[model samples]
Every structure is written in C-alpha cells, then in structure tokens.
Target chain A: MKPQGIKVLQLMSSRINKYLIISLQIGFLFGFYLVGGYLQKTLALPVPGSVVGMLILLIGLYLKWIPIQWISQGASALLNHLPLLFVPVTVGIMQHLDFFSGKSLWLVPIVLVSTWIVMGATGLLGQFLANRKEWDR
Target chain B: MMLLQMFFWLFITLLLYVVFRRLYQLLPYPFMIPVLTCTVVLVVVLTSFDVSYDTYFSGGQWIDALLGPAIVALAFPLYKQRKLLNKFKVEIFATVVTASLLGILSGYWLAVVSGYNEMIVSTIISKNVTTPVAMEVASMTGGQPAFAVIFVMIAGIGGAVTGPWLFQLLGISNFLGIGMAFGGASHAIGTAKALEYGEREAAISSIGLSLCALCVSLLGPLLLKWIS
Candidate 1:
C-alpha cells in the first residue's frame, strides 16, 4: 500500500510484460517452423523449412499481422547471437577434411576467385547504375 | 545420464566460445575472426579429449536449432528498412540478379573445368548465398549439404575479410555498391561485417543477401538441369 510497495509491484509487472512479449515472439517463430516442416514433408519441396519460416515471418510483418514491437526485441536478440548458432556447423566441417584432398584442391581457389568476381561485378555494376542517374541529372 | 553429459560438455564449449570471442576482439589481426577461432579451439579440445563430432553434436545440435529462429528474426531488420527497400528496389534487384548469375556461372564452370565431380560442382554453385539456402540448393541439385556448408563458409568468410579492401582497390566508394557486393558474395557473415560501416550498408546488405538467396533458389535447379 505504501510508495515502495507500489513501485515494486510496477517493476514486477513490467518485467513480466517483457518476458511475455519475448515468449510470444519465439512462439510465432516456432509456429512458422512447424508449418514449414509440414509443407516440406508433405509436399517434398526443395526449399528448407527454415527458409520457408523466414518467408512466413516476412509476410507476417509485411501484411501487418505481426506488430514490430512484438517481435523486435526477441528478433534482435536472435540476430545478435546468430553467429554463435553456426559454430556447430562450422566445426562440423572438420568431419569432412578429406573432401579437400586431390582434385578437390581447386575447391579453395574456385570459391575464392568466384567470391572476388561476384564482389567486383556487383560493386562495379551497382556503382555505375547509382551514378548513372546522378550524371543524367 | 548421457544427455546430461552432453549438455555439460556443450556448456563448456559455449563458455570457451565466449571467452575466445572476446579475446579475438581484443586482438588486432583481421584473420582472427571470432567464429573461426572458436571453432578451431573447440575442434582442438574435442580432438585432444577424443570426443567424436557425433558426441559433441548431440548437445551442439540444440544450439544449431536456434538458427531457424535467428533467420526468421532477420525479417525484423528487413522490415525496419522497408523504406530503403522501396527507394532502391529496381537497382537492388538488378545488381543482385547480375551478381548472383555471375557467381553461379563462375563457380560452376570452374568446378567443371577442374574435373571435380557433379556433386562438387553443385555444391559450389550455391556458395554465394547464406548457409541454409546454400545447403538446400546443394541438396536439391544432388550435392552434399555438408560440402555446401564448407563452400559457403569459405565464400562468406573470405568475402567478409577482403570485401572492403577489394572495393577500395577497385575504386568503388559507394556504400550501396559495397553493401550489395558483400551481401551478394558473402551472405550473412559479410552482411555482419557490412553493419560496421553503417545502417544503410547493413540494410542494403540484407537486401542483397535475401535477393541472392531468392535468385539461387529459383534459378539454381534450372541452371543445373540445363547444364547437365
């Protein structure tokens, strides 16, 4: 009933609200994953369930069905920790060390050169188009 | 009981990852990427202790499970930048398509010319996109998803490492171009690096990454079929 007691009650309520929003965001994400998995299994789509889940979330946001504030906090938290999730797969690369042997020696060079080509081509092409409008103006 | 042991060991791995990640940030070397460093450390520790990848993955798979949620979360950032998407919609689409096509052709032809198997060629074809999409494309095209992951990581990490410098060397100073190049070529890791430049670069990078994935998913199968 006192001022301190009221303040404590407000803080607890706000904390609970924060946790509630996070749970809802995660629930939505998991729901999409389930839908994607179902589609993949039943339809035999080539797309991965995760990619389908991503599209579902994107459509939710675009259609205004999902509030930004509802998902932003949990979403950003997941994105911030994204690299950590990939560590297992990256480490899993160690399991296939033999794939790099013999003729596969070209694999590294091919990946490196293609990356450079893509970067250069995209940069140059984008810059040219971006500047073309300016020059025309 | 076995599950408990797996959880305990994975917890240790995660703890070591955090410590090493912080340590890598404090170091000055560009090659000292946190993920790569943490991976090397975990692999060494596991190998030293004779822990098989399967045992480690028993618990590690829990962390990997979050990847789907993390990807879905990307929609938030993409949503925030919707205005930018509208502004540069045509240019973004154009650049991504061109770059993705270039990447696929270069990767595929080189692999073929090098006399690698069809599987290797297919894996290399999807290296320009993020891991999940890349793996899917690889599998759809009859390649090994594990091999695709390796190729994707190499492309992503290599692009993140050298992207800015390469752009500068090529005399391209436009942030749009740099961001697009990073996203189209390197995927998520490159986009993460691009975020350091500013919000605009990050937004454009996300666009590039997504468009790259879309193009690969749609065109990759057709291209492989035509080539065969």
Candidate 2:
C-alpha cells in the first residue's frame, strides 16, 4: 500500500476514536444528570436535580472517584456551547411580553442601578480585605 | 406536519445560533453577544410571522432540554479549581458569601420598590448568578425561568461593561478584588472580561462566579424567606 494511503487511514481512525470518546463522555454526563433527578424525586429536595448532579460530580471528582478525563471533553464541549442552549429559553420570553409592559419596564433602570450598587460594594469590600490579608502576610 | 414544524424551529435556532456565534467572534461587540442577539432576532422573526411561542417551543424545547445536562457539566469547572479553591477559599468565601447575600438583598429591595409581584421578586432574586443556575434557582423558588434569564443577561453584560472602568475608577487593582467583585456580581461574562486582566485573574473570577452561584443556589431560598 502507498504510504499516503496508510497515513490517511490512520488519520481517519483517530478521528473516529476521538468522536467515540466524546460521545461516551457525554453519555456519562447524562447518566449523572439522571441520578440527580432520581435523588431529587426520592429526597424531595428543593434544589434542582441538575444542580445536585453538579454537586455530586464535584464531590466525585474531588474525591478522585471520577477521573477528570471521564468528562473533560464532554464537559468543555457543553460548557463552551452553554450559551447557545439558553437561546430557546430566552426566546420563551416572548410569551411573557405583557409582564414587561407598563411601569414594569422600570426593570431596565432598576437593574442598572442595582448592578452598579452591588458591584461597587462587593469590589470595595473585596479589595479592602484582600489588601489587609496581604499586609498581614 | 407536526414533526416537520418541530424540526424546522430546531434547525432554525441552531442555524441562527451558529451563524451569529461566528459573527460575534468576528465582531466581539457587546451587543453582538450571541445569546442576546439570537434571542432578539428569533423573537422578532417569530413575532412577525405570527407564530405563538408555544408553537415555536414545540421545536425549541428540544434545545431547552440540553440545559439539564449542561448544568451538570458545570461541575467540571469547579472541580478544575480545587487548588485555587483552597488557597483563596477564605477571601473568595468571605466576599462571595457577603456578595451573594447582598446581591439577593439588593434585588429584593429593588423589586419591592418597583412593585413587582412575588413571582417577579423571586425571579429577580437570582439575577446575579450565572444564567443556567439562575434559571434553576428561580424555577425552584417558584419564579419564571425565562424571566430570570433576562435579569442574568442584564447583570452579566452590565457588569462586564462597567466593572473594569469601575475598578480603575475606584483604584481597586488587586487581582483578587477584580475577580471576586466581577465574578460574584457578573458571573460568566464578567469572568470573560477578567481575561483581559490576566489568566490568574480569570481563574479567580471563575471561582468567584461558581462560589457565588453555589451560595445563591443553596442560601438563596432561605435568604429570600428570611428577608421577605
């Protein structure tokens, strides 16, 4: 066989393997999500199952039970594209337009003011304490 | 026909999301944020076409379902931060906890002032957290998930835009302060903005974002109950 043909075959095989690994890791994420849902139903927890799933994964990873490689690709893939997932949910706002009408639109300025106030407060406190800690050290 | 319609909305959403995401990358403008832009464009298109949201969501729901696993995927980042978590846990915790509680207070106060109902108040309460988590927190607390997202966007973008200048204005130059303040207040977008400061700052920003998210998720319900 030509060397070029062999190289092309190897490349194609690696690509297939990469995809298989990605899909398998994604399957793991879904499995954790399901377990989270199950725990939520049985425990009647107020916390959302997905959030629970995340905590479980965090504990699992931290304790070295779940290797990072297990979900690195899948997790990064999902997180990177996470913003895209919200497009539909955000679009869902169209149904609730009446809620945004009337004086309720005051939300715009209210958000601007609150964000400024809260952000400013947090920054000042964080800066002060962190600098103090540096001085202590 | 039902199946075709369902596929159509789903396809259109994916198409718009991908194309706009590319454009956002090329443009990198604040208004070009793919999610906001896509939402605006899709909403306008659907509204002009006289299609009800329910009908559009018949297909869009497929996309929405991905949010569940995506939330679970959130753990990956927190896990990656194990080292930073311990090293700066004190500062991150001290500031983010206060920030989280204070953030909730601020939102609740404003909602009351604005005469918002319990539903809107609860929705507003989670505004400072990341989008997916905020949605979950809002839903768990009996707020509208969709409505919660709007506030998250406003807070995230608003923080990203104003935070750097705010920091420079106040002469707060420590990486810890820059990160914690931005992350606790702004979430993902703020963390992205922190990338300009440096990688360490971005790392701190991410941890701050997650810790604030965790605080808001766990303590948010009880805080709302106590404050309300």
Best by DockQ: 1
- The stretch of ten residues in a row with the least summed lDDT in candidate 1 chain A is A45-54
Cα lDDT tens digits, model 1, B1-228, are 888968986797689778876876688355676667778788888888887888888888888877777666767777888887787788898999998899899999988888888888888999999887888898888998888888998998888778867887999878779889989999888877776677677778877887788898889888989987
Those runs of model 1 whose alpha carbons end farther than 4 Å from true positions after fitting are: A1-24, A40-46, A133-137
Residue by residue across B24-110, what tens digits does model 2's lDDT show? 889876567677788889989999999998889999998888777877886776677667667777887788888898888888898
DockQ of each: 0.63, 0.56
lDDT of 1 by residue, A1-137 (tens): 69999999999999998878887787777777778767867887655676667777788889999878778887876676666777887788778768779767669988999999999999998888878855876
Off by over 4 Å in 2: A127-137, B114-123, B130-153, B156-175, B186-214, B217-228
What are the lDDT figures for the candidates, one per model? 0.82, 0.80
